[model samples]
Target: MSGPAAALSASPAGTGPDQVRGPVITGWSAVSPYGIGRDAFVQGVSSGRATVSVLDTERWPGPDELACLVPDFDVREVLGKKGTRSMDRVSGLAVTAVRELIAESEGAGLPAGGEEVALVLGTTTGSAQSMMDITRDTLIHEKPFYIDPSHIPNALMNCAAGQCAIWYGLKGPNTTVAGGRASGLLALNYARRLLTAGRAHTILCGAAEEYSPARSWLERHTRHPDENATVLGEGCAVLRLQPPGTHPHPLAELLCITTAITHPHHITTTLAHTIKRALHQTRLNPHDIWAVSPSTPPGTTADHERHALDLIFTDHTPHHIPAPGPIGDTAAATATFQITTLLSHHQQHPQPPNRIALITAIDRDGVLATALLRLL
Candidate 1:
């Protein structure tokens, strides 16, 4: 897309910005099939090589399947032995990613006290393996008390977010949003609202999914028979967001977040309107967008997303990037990966400061979300 690049001027409403300022993304970290850290994620996606590979069926006991898995990651390395013993795979990924973000923000002196920071993570069907194990134990043994007590906490949908707070000692508002593929965008919106309400000085926000035996089996059994359904993938990306003007050197400015629920009959129209709303909220025109990342994986969702994009930017074809093909379907982490892709592109190409990019996602549950970001 080509147009006169505009700089960010006014802060979003309800955010209580002393000056016209937007929320800034100061630091971030990731753990993905590429490996640990954001550098690996950037290099892996930039390389344009598919990170997905055939999963071991013997171990997982699922039909033929492929997944993008974090390679050779051991939670013990980040949390030590005792800390990781009771942690599930999802919690491990969340803790490890947050730890990386904190290490990256070292000299910046981030909020160290428990109440100074908030944790908002997005997930879908959290800790499926742990839940299944305990369920099986209880059902097979014919006793409610037969399930392992240590696994009880892992059965909760908010386990990953809750464990993150415990591990990092964050006492601020802790939350977990279950929005399927739209979870990342939902978490971002929630964090923005918390900042707007002045609930916390800083927010550690992101989404994570785990590639486990149970998850793979569940996907194989429940996935639609569409030939182009997304492949299961696992990863996490945690970003540190501060209220606008709080960061001296921010990677990007978050302009706006828009989301809506639509049915199949009105998906295209709804998505188009949602995208337009984001543009209107940020006072940006279609041409001002440097690029866009669509979070639709494949099949009907991809078709709907394409139809909406065609309608929104008819003549001007922005550098639209389809995320799932390159990284597989990360579910809840889809939007986060899209944002990371745009950030990586800005870093490598060094766009004129303030050039904007759009990230849009449609969850499996029909929730459409759009977020506008400006490189800074």
Candidate 2:
């Protein structure tokens, strides 16, 4: 009981019965480029080792030759040889992450499965390669409509979430949210709403991304020509969220999640305003945030995000925890990874009670999101 578990059980000096409470993160798991599970991710980020590796052109030919992929990740091998023949990479990643999360929850003396537990998964697009391949087969076959039915499920945008629910027998609300890099935060917000509405008692929330030639080519064509290409990364991170005071060993309390959309030219100002609003709503000042994790990929968006952060924290500079440098551009999973990064850092450094951590995410489609978490 000397680690996070102990911290959660002890009441902080200033906290009282009147203290406000929000959704609490009780447990989490990750399937990351560094390897798999929360320990691998924490170790990789803590060691500051590079996870990028050379791609095999024969297997994954694409515009980019390098990527940060979950090493030695084979669907059948990792998930076993049953019911995985037609499983796409994204679905496999999601299922694996949820499986780990359920196990972690059970280990922490919580019921891992029940009718009231929900699942909310976020993604930019389910599996680009599965969709493209299915389309190619449809046109090249003797009959235009002839295609593998087994692969059809993977082509849908909700495939990963559906697979997770099916695998876990989750009877509560199952949802899929799509918002590019802002997807993780969007999913978190969705889970919070579900709790507030009394739709579920517990929620498994996170995002998953897969690295493939289809996604690589799509990113290449969509990116601005002047911007330098970053090494694409893929993985999944899932957190178990329960209503505040429901869990005894909570890791952090989520105060607020705010998002905004604006014209590309006004992104900086809009994001600054969004951050300020989140702070005001939480009744916390800039100096209260002990760390900041910003989803900075590269180029103009990164500059705009930095500018927005500078605008708010003019007097107090929080410790920066960068996500992309070690994990690459995780796309949909960026924000989720940022939260995991803060959690992992807290485990090692043991921040004081009630200290805050902030996360900001921006997507190329003019979506900006901010979340504030109070460490236990």
Candidate 3:
């Protein structure tokens, strides 16, 4: 075993309380364009293979012809036949990712389900296709009220989170946040607060997005006319978060997570400030950072993010792990994939103990976020 497989095989067996100071990430799983499990994602990223594929125009009629979709992912096939008659792509992705995370946790001899567990998911919108389809039916049918009752749930933004809770028997806190590209960090921050307030014993924090003609059309119309259109993509990533010492085998310790809203004109300064605040809160200097995973989509926003990072790390250069471009623009799941990239990089390339990794995210809608993690 060599490369990423060898690194993954060398994961720490356990850690002590004194070794980790904040909430620890016990495990994580992702359904990416690369494939379905953590290993697939790690290998796809490590190998740098292309994930973009031409879309079937009949199934996905839109301006964009290519997308980074989960290969051969069928809702009914991936999930099952029962209770999936109306399951949309987004919900299926979320449910599958969460299910994988639960299985990983249980395999590691860790508790995963019960009343003590909570779920927090982030998304741009539920399923644009489902919503548009229902609306179209209502308007086209002779009777205005004619619509599929089963598809109603898929249109709601909280449907994915709700489904995870119901399916996994998590009775604690269930929340859905909408923050565009910064959603993953926002979800992480919300999960940490829940743990601090004693709202739940553990939290499944992540984000999900789906690729569809409706979303593609929405992107085409919303994007700046001058900016180059990005290749839309979709996926989901979920992490099992618990307070320090709750689990001995941690992937990383969450030092701090911070977010802010500012005008687009002040994005660079605001993001720099957010990063500085996270560093201060964690009592870490820029020089302590060993690597960075940034979720800055292409165009003006990417330049702004680069400027912000340059402003903060003027003294030294930390190794940069570029965003998962091979996976295309994951939207809400951008930050989650960014975090996962850092973890995978650490595993493949061993670093000194207590070395920190930084993750920064910026959304066109004035949302900026920063998170610091200590690799274990």
TM-score on alpha carbons, each prediction: 0.92, 0.94, 0.94
Highest lDDT among the candidates is held by which one? 2
**Candidate lDDT (C-alpha), each:** 0.80, 0.86, 0.85
Error of 3 at 292 (Å): 1.3
Ranking by TM-score: 2, 3, 1
Instruction: Report the backbone clash tally of model 2.
Output: 0
Task: Tell me the lDDT of model 1 at 376.
Answer: 80
**Candidate 3 displacement at residue 81 in angstroms:** 0.4
Deviation in Å, model 2, residue 340 alpha carbon: 0.1
lDDT of 1 by residue, 1-376 (tens): 1211122333443332234366678888898888889898878767877787877778666654777778776677667897678788889998889888888887764877768799999998898998998888988896778767888999999999998888878999999998888899899989887777678888999999988888877777766566345677788899898865566778887888999998856878999999999888767778878788988655676788888988989778788655745667788888888888777766777866766788988875578899988778
- For model 1, name the residue pairs that clash: none
Query: How do the residues 249-294 of candidate 3 rate in per-residue lDDT, one tens digit apiece?
Result: 6788887888999999899999999999888776677888888888
Residue lDDT tens for model 2, 1-376: 3423332232222353335356788899999988888888889878989889999999999988899999999999999988899999999999999988887777564545568889999899989999999999988999977998999999999999999989888989999999989999999999988877778888999999999999999989888864556788999999998876777778988788999989877889999999998988867778888899999856788888999899999999999987746678889999999999889988988866777789999997788899988788
User: Which residue ranges in model 2 land beyond 4 Å of their true spot?
Assistant: 1-20, 107-109
Supply the TM-score for candidate 2: 0.94
